[model samples]
Target: MLLYGSTDSGHSYKIRAFLLLTASPHAYQWIDLALPQSHRLAAFVAASKFGEVPVLLDQGQAMCQSNAILMYLAQRVGKLAGAETEWQGVLEWLSWESNRIGFSLPNLRYALRWSAQPPEVLHYLRQRVLADLARLDAAVSAQDFLLPSGPSIADLSCSAYLFWLDQVGIDESAYPHLQRWLARLRALPHWQHPDLAMQAVAPDTSLARDE
Candidate 1:
């Protein structure tokens, strides 16, 4: 399998991190998005459908979307998404990532893009981020993970985003449960390390100044 992604992209990092953590021997080709060079390539678009990074090629078939790919590979290796009793728990958390965790993403990128913008303009994002942190904090408070006792695709889907959220100066301290959950995730043996995702983002002015 070959993965085409950028190290600076969290969406891509999620996929690469999983492959590495699982010790999956796959070839990775870094696609630079510095100028939208490869993104418009016909071959890439055809393979990835939407020409998105972190595209995975498995058995001559192309799969796009990081979460989808994660689910595919996890099942490929026999890792079940949830226990019999917690099936809906698994579904809910993953769905939450699609919208809830997703809202914080664009705001983060916008902050990185317009770092020179006024604090007032970024205030909305800060509020949104704080709200997300609160929601996630409450959700994970009772369980060691999204599920009560085990890690699943839900956790993997959320791991990279949460790591990036904290690094970007979201004031994780405001959410103690989130901080503790992050610490617990960091200690897991099969945990996917989020180095480039963390590195891809810098602490923005909101995190540095207002913080």
Candidate 2:
């Protein structure tokens, strides 16, 4: 299996974490978004319909989108996919994450780290992020994971970008339950920090940062 991704992308990190947690055998290729499209690997360019990273190639088949890849991996490995009855809940949480926390947190991080946004825009993103964090904290307060079954792809998807809370200037300490959940995830066997998991060839520093 071959995975194409970028080190700085939380979306990419989601797959990396899942692969590590499952101890799946695979090779990772770091795609430099800074380079011109023509300069990128032809296989990656052809595989990524949206010109995005976190694309997975296995047995001559290609998969795109982070959440989709997660679901595929979960089903393939028979782990982290949750029980048959809980599949709907898992899907719900994944959808929620994609629309809510997944959207706000990454955008806020980009605005802060890659490019500066207008004050009003930043404020809007921050408010959305805070609200999403509160929702997550409340959801996991009573349960050990997002679903009753246990840690599913939902948890992995939602928690992916959160490891970089400090980079985006969010005080992770403020969200106690969330922090605890993160700790639980960190304790999982074979878990590695995104930086270490996704590390690869350095990209050109002169180009604009990826979202």
Candidate lDDT values, in order = 0.67, 0.89
Candidate 1 overall lDDT versus native? 0.67
Report lDDT (Cα) of residue 68, candidate 2.
94
TM-score winner: 2
Give the alpha carbon lDDT tens digit for every residue of 116-174 in model 2: 99999999999999999999999999999998888889999999999999987888889
- Could you give candidate 1's per-residue lDDT for residues 56-147 as a string of tens digits? 87777888887888878777765646676776777677678767666665556557564555777577666777777788789788877778
Could you say which candidate leads in lDDT? 2
Candidate 2 segments exceeding 4 Å error: 201-211
Task: Give the TM-score comparing model 2 with the true structure, all chains together.
Answer: 0.93
Off by over 4 Å in 1: 38-45, 113-121, 190-192, 196-211
Per-residue lDDT value at 159 in model 1: 58
